[model samples]
Target: EKVQLLIARKIELFWTRNFSEAIPYNNLVIGVPKEVWRNEKRIALTPSIAANLVKKGFRVRIERNAGLNAMFSNEEFEKEGATICNKSECFQSDIILKVRQPLISEVDEFNEEATIISFLYPAQNQQLINKLSV
Candidate 1:
């Protein structure tokens, strides 16, 4: 019981120390795009995670139906302060998060200054790397 109490206290302290104050808004935006890779069903960010980011003063934009495959509804994300937008609008964000590598053609939709985070198999898809590097 005592050990459990100590662990709980530590967890509480961690949350308080990290999330007690909202970070000043610096115009940082994170976009979540739907997985286009075949058989990929997971989404990069969940509604809860988006909510946390919003509380920290970050803007989150999710492409329409991005989380549908993961059993998360668009309304769920919107309730957490995320904006649901079309794929093109979501791709315009400063940072893009995806569960799988985007299609080669979709790479051209990304903003030149945007950063992409996803499970990429660069070794197997040299063409994708070349396109993304351009």
Candidate 2:
């Protein structure tokens, strides 16, 4: 819990200190996966969050139909200045925020050097740790 809080605080601080530069000036790209697994309906980053990031000058790209199951549409995200992209292009982003770890099938979509962050179910996902080690 302490670690989580500290990480959260660090994220908040990062946004506070660097959001202005990170978004507009640096051409930061963020990727979000379309939910594929069962019972994963929640989107880790919503259009509202995308809007905030854009307001700070960041460019966000999301996988096609990623938010459809969540009742979010491509038009809504586009309205917030986020670009809709194929899974491959989404993985080319500088950073990725995913609700779940990359599945074996989607592993190829990730760029070799991009930073991908996601939640892993350790008990059932030892393979994810190994895959991400790449």
For model 2, name the residue pairs that clash: 23-57, 23-58, 24-57
> Candidate 2: what lDDT?
0.81
Local distance difference test, each candidate: 0.91, 0.81
Q: Which stretches of candidate 2 lie over 4 Å from their true place?
A: 1-25
lDDT of 2 by residue, 1-134 (tens): 99999999998888787433334534778888787788888776799999998887777998888898888998889899889999888888888888977787677677777777788777788887777776
- Candidate 2's TM-score reads 0.75
lDDT of 1 at 82: 98
Cα lDDT tens digits for candidate 1, 1-134: 99999999999998777555643555888999888878888999999999999998889999999999999999999999999999999999989998788899999999888989987799988999999998
Candidate RMSDs in Å, in order, are 9.9, 9.8
